[model samples]
Target chain A: MCGIAALQLKDPALRPQLGSMMHAMLCEIVDRGPDSAGIAVYDVERFVHAGQSTVTLLDSPSSDEELSAALAAELPSAGAVEVRTLGDTTLVSAAVDTAILTAALRAVAPGARQIGRGTHVANLKGVGNPVDLAETFGLASVSGTQGVSHTRMATESAVTASGSHPFTVDDDLCLVHNGSFSNHATIRRGLRAQGIEFDSENDSEVAARYLAMRLREGDDLTTGLENLRETFDGFYTLVVTTADGLAVLRDPIACKPAIIAETDQWVAVASEYRALVDLPGIETANIFEPEPGEVYTWEF
Target chain B: MGVLNEEVVDLHVSTVRELNSALHKAHDGEHWRVTNPGGAHNVAVGIDSEIDVVIDGHVGYFAAGMHQKGTVTIEGSAGTGLAENMMSGRVHVKGNASQSAGATAHGGLLVIDGTTGARCGISMKGVDIVVGGNVGHMSAFMAQAGRLVICGDAGDSLGDSIYETRIYLKGQARSLGSDCIEKPMREEHLAELAELLAAAGRTESPSEFRRYGSARTLYHFHSENSSAY
Candidate 1:
């Protein structure tokens, strides 16, 4: 029900055009999501820049009025903030310290986590098409060797910014998920009991925070994602981004779709073939779907 | 029918790249009769224009993927994925089709005249499928919407993990998959089947077909009962 796209550029020069490539990939998947849009870009030298703040993961689609009120309460008391409501969701963007912003986001949306931090290298997400979000957010100009994105249709959740893909758990890691989670409530309750607070009710955030928790427990991203292959229920294809590499994982059932295509200079992954069509010099032989329950990684 | 004089476009000699080019050249909403189509894969791929395209012979994999707003008729048997991911339009097959017919299609209608292989109309979304003969195993697996009509028998694991789609079968089904069950045919169902039968040009009475769909049993997963299906 959602579209996920990422690029692991081997050359830094490609960063400037990252937004455009992401835009192209997202455009093909416009049908998947048409609610709201956002993007996160990761670069080697600078701190990650995530445009738009109103993005949240919710359990179900809410009303725009409800989101506006929630975001207003989440922001710092003294800071100037503007909340824009899209559907049953609200986005609040501000020029503030990343740490403080993260804290405020968590304070307001207690269960919501700030997934991208100073150390996390992957920038991912989108409300509609990942491609369109990238274009609107100026991601095409980015020149990173690796990245990830998503276009969500809200199969389980409602069509709102909070239900969009790319739920971040900590600063260093973020995840974009396609497919539904059967045991999301169970997992959410388990995590909540262990003191893991959540902002949105989205099942995707539960999985993302789970991986983040595993990372905090000393498991590498690959191992953390692989461990969940059998642990979670329903169909899922997850793309994880880190400073060193881009990782892709699918559920054991492989019920959903995720394709991979590689060229001499770049390796690209998407939910469908059309998303990868615009890649430079892509041929029929270069395209293939990721095996179910398997994880594919591309290093920077 | 007045000699349906039309230029037959053969896909065997054409690549997907070339076929797409020709498909774009045909004016939107215009009728261009086609024929002599061999086993060219991905024919009529990504067609969004509202036009009519007919193929005379057998086809290969993904024959009409991403189709939108038009009519495509094939006189012979079709390969696997006859309408993979089709967005809209109608595809009629005079002969049987291979596996995964209309896989992941979002909308439109797909008609098959002969027996279909495994996984017919898998994960179909809002697409109507009609088959004249038997359908293979796992037919209508994970279907989301639209109607699926079978004039003959169905294989094992029929309608597994189905959503809100409707399924009509005239013959026996080996087994029903997860969350699917047989229901008593109601008056409304009878009327619906009559329309489908008329569209497929079948004279069979509506009473001959049994109705099957999601039983609303397994919407959510339960570890203890998951194995029961």
Candidate 2:
């Protein structure tokens, strides 16, 4: 089983302090999922577009100098691609003509679009252990107020870093799933008909894309989550991180476990309470298992 | 004797391994006094020797799960699935029990003093269970072989698709499933009820009980009985 940890900091100063806490929470659940770990922080002011937008990943791990040069070079035709580096991995966030960025990144590197972000976007996955990804991208010390992190077990998908979780849809919403999607094939076909693109053949991405499409159609995160819970048939506990807040939802059967612990300072969610074991004042915290079919939302 | 009136063994422990190990050492033909058992799962699980293990408070899921060859008693309400999948042994609860009590149990005795939730004794194999208060809906559903004795009213669809299990109730059942029916009480049944009542620690007369069992018409699947599925 894969493990997911999402922390919504009530304090802005604590926002940057989240990198260690996210690392701390994910490290505790190392046993649940040990393959690869990834974290995504959404700076809403940076990655939104007014009209038609295109998102893609930069192929090569760009240096700070190389990234600034590329941004300076691409900004004339491309609308805006926000640049944020976790360590060695630099995420160039952009919303432009899909055809334009697609041509641009491919001309620079053959597989550039493989690491890209788009409209209705999400970006938190890697190819190895959380430590390796943290080292490779410099996430061990990075922090943000609201984000989602996942360590993968790789049951359905191959054990590649890209197959690890917190899958993003279009770039606005990111979802981490604990259980399998029973009706994934049917939904995948339906989305394919509706012109949704996919990278990997994982059910979690399909789930994320479905929710992202719903959110894009003017549904709030909570409403989109409820729709996903109603439409999707299986045992899944999903924690969705968006620009405004985070929403946690569980399937009706509740075959999977999702625990919630909250304090006046922040609200933390994990597959088990053991993930929150290291947090101070945990003994006095109001912790509980999330009820089946309930949507729990925490705004950052 | 010491100055203390009684010795209380505080079983305020963590982990299933620790709790079960302490119970084995304490229950050696002496009355073991325990308190503050806060929601421990599988407390009396796999205990096959004859001893009285008394718990002071509530228990978590599967408290007396799979018990055999001993008597385990609980003082307060139990979480989901108490005495689940138990084999021969006795589990006596003084308080209420959650859903699926005695579920799929084989060759044991489960006695509940209060109400049992939905699907109580569901798919029971051969265990004998007696409930003092009302039982929830779908009790004895898919039951294959066992005896369920209820003193209070039974909820909807009682004995749904039950197989060789015998059912006795003092109050009314909402409905009976296919192949299950109310039957006339015989002298042999009255004798069996007397033993079950004595085991459950009840002074009530056995004649108040009514017997229910398979009609045997559904021993084999027929096209006419296909609707039961």
Candidate 3:
């Protein structure tokens, strides 16, 4: 079992409390998953710089200086590159075309794994206690309007930094999963034949890639999730975050556990209610479990 | 009886063992109050005697699981497998519940004041589940006995491969599974449903519901039924 928690503030006034609230939620579910933890923060102002693309990297073999030099040589048109280290991941922000910069970074640091590329989303993940990982990344102090976090138990693939959760396949898009996919291999082969590359052997990564492909083809968030329902086979409770919204979806069978508690100020989705019990205004929130095959989305 | 006071245990400060031990040691008709459950899993499980347990906050998985002869009430939402495999007595949740709320339960009354997630009564052998709100997909799957009363909507595939478990739905059903057909509600069914509603503290009229059960088409395998299979 894995623990997944997501929060989207309906009012921007609550953005400052997002990190601490998410940290508290993750701590409640530490027993559900103790192998690894990850969080993707979408602070519109802090993480996302104007005219710049932020890329998160995991297991970087090169130091910041070497990586910066390589990026400069690969993309001469790109501006200065700034890198911040957090645990095993690095956040790189540069004023350049996102696609070009992503490709250049991939080539320069072949040993480094890309976590996500976007304007607002910055992800940090590692193998350890979720609480300690949160502290290491200063999650309680980082401010964000919306975010998604996960604590993984490693049911399908090896437990490593590359295999950790909060897998992002597109700009400002990330997915955290709580269950296994039954037909991922078949779908993975299909995507590969269509020229889509994968970074991990995780089933949830395939789902993120599938949704990203759909979104890239101009499908809306709701339609992409609906298509996901038709194509994927498994028991999953997914918390998907985008540039403007957050969504919660369960498999058609609804085997996995998920709860949604919403108040006037925010919407929170977690694998269990205890994760939300401590949230502000939870006592009066309208809490319910999302129905199977239904995508519940809240746009910021 | 006049001198005995109701026992109160705080889950925030006391262990589950302490609360359960008190229940196990209490005599018949003893009342216990559990405060600050904080959504802990497996609370108040395996009770074998007639008693009363009132939990003041949310509970996690398997709350009142394998229960017997105890009336347990949760004031907030429950995690998966609430009252699972219960053999007797009544278990009630005042708020929404997670998946498998009454899975495989036998001989008990499980009531939810709000909605319940998928597989609410899956694989139930003998139990009566009454939900004030909606029930998720695959509810009552492979049920062998007892009844399920849903006051609101039911998600996809209600009563798949069910046997002898009478389902009464007051609201819409997305769809029914194979061999599970909606049957006409008769006078006897109305009376039975009325009793169940009363037991669940609901005031809805039984005539508003429709009954569903097995069509007996898949009960026996034969060459003629090969295509159906």
Candidate 4:
């Protein structure tokens, strides 16, 4: 089993405490998954900025200055590249399109494994206790508008950084899964025929790639997930974060656990109630489980 | 609420093991007030005494599980497996419940005031489950022996491949599982339903509900009917 804790702050005042709150929620669900973990934060100013694109990679071979210099040289039009290290991941921000930025980074750091890329997403993950990984990433001190986290139990793949979830293959679209897909291999073959490359042997990575392909084909977040529901068969409880909002979906049987809590201040979803109990207004929040085979979306 | 001889145990201040140990060794007449549950799993589990417990907040998985003799109440919603394999007791949930609210319970009365997630009472044995609100999918799948009373609607597969269990549904079911069908209600079933409603503090008439049970079609496997199994 895996664990998930995602929080999207509606009130601007609550943004400053996004990291701390998600850390608390993640800590509560750590017992569900202790093999490896990942987190994604959407902070406009910290991860991405106005008219700029951001991409994070796990363990780049070059230093910050070297990577930044190479990226700037590769695409002179993409000016002023900034690179910083958090945990074992590196965050690179540039004033250019996400495609252009990521392409340039790929040319410069060919061996680096990209984990997150978008206008407002930062990803960091590792193979250890989730709380320890959070501490290394300074998750408690980071500020953001929304955050999604996952702790993996490693059913369909090896315990590697690339296998950790919050799979941000698409720009500003991060998806975390709590269950495995049974027919993913068949779907993976279909997606591969469509030229959607995968980075790992994990089943959840197949879902992330499938969603990215759907969004690229003009499917909205909810519709992409709905299409996935009809295409893939298995138990799944997913919480996906995009540039503008968050959405949650479960399989028809709904064997996996997911509870959603919503209020004016925030909208939160977790694999268990233990994750949401520490929120500021959770006692008064309207909490309910999402209906099976239904999609719940919240736009910020 | 029992101030005369009530003992308040705050989960924040004491460990869950400490609380369960106390409840297991407590006297028959003792009343306990558990505060700040914080959705912790296995809170007050495996109790074997005639004690009264009231949890002030939400609980995690398997709360009041394997209970022998106790009256445990949750003021908030409960997580998965609210009271699995309970020998004897009364568990009350004031809010909604997650998946598998009561699974394989040998004996007890579990009452949920709000709606529940999927598989509310799968494979129950000799327990009585009363839901004031709707139950989720596969509410009583393969239930061996029990009485399930649903005041609201039921989700998909109300009782799949059930055995000996009696189901009383007041509202609609999305779909019925194999070997489970609506049975004609008679006088004894109505009387038993009325008593169950009263035991759960419900006021709905027994006539308003519909009874369901196994058709016994798949009970004895045969060569000609082997495909259904």
Interface RMSD of 4: 0.5
**Candidate with best TM-score:** 4
lDDT of 1 at B219: 80
| DockQ of predictions, in order shown | 0.04, 0.08, 0.76, 0.90
Ordered from best to worst lDDT, the candidate numbers read 4, 3, 2, 1
The candidate, 1 or 2, that scores higher on TM-score is 2
> How would you encode candidate 2's per-residue C-alpha lDDT over B1-229 as one tens digit per residue?
2122333445454556776766666544544445666545566677766767778766666888878767788976565678888898789898777678999999889999988766789999999999998887788988998889999988777898888888989999877776679999999889989998888987768788888887777666689867978
> Residue B24 error for model 3, in Å?
2.5
TM-score of 1: 0.54
Estimated TM-score per prediction?
A: 0.54, 0.62, 0.94, 0.97
Which ranges in model 3 have alpha carbons more than 4 Å from their true place?
Answer: A44-48, A69-79, B1-4, B184-187, B226-229
The fnat score for candidate 4 comes to: 0.88
Ranking by TM-score: 4, 3, 2, 1
For DockQ, candidate 1 versus 2, the one ahead is: 2
Model 3 agreement with the true structure over B1-229: per-residue lDDT tens digits: 3115778899889998888877888788888889899888889998888988888989988999999997999999899999999998999999888888889999889999999888889999899999999998899999999999999999989999999999999999999987899998988999999999999999999988999999988787789767966
Alpha carbon lDDT of residue A138, candidate 2?
A: 48
The CA-based lDDT of model 2 is what? 0.72
- Give the candidate number with the greatest lDDT: 4
CA RMSD of all predictions: 13.4, 7.7, 2.5, 1.5
For each candidate, the alpha-carbon lDDT, in order, equals: 0.70, 0.72, 0.89, 0.91
DockQ of the two-chain complex in candidate 1 = 0.04
- CAPRI level of candidate 1: incorrect
Model 4 clashing residue pairs (backbone): B126-B145
Query: Taking the tens digit of each residue's C-alpha lDDT, what string does model 1 give over A79-115?
Result: 4544433222333444455465556656566543333
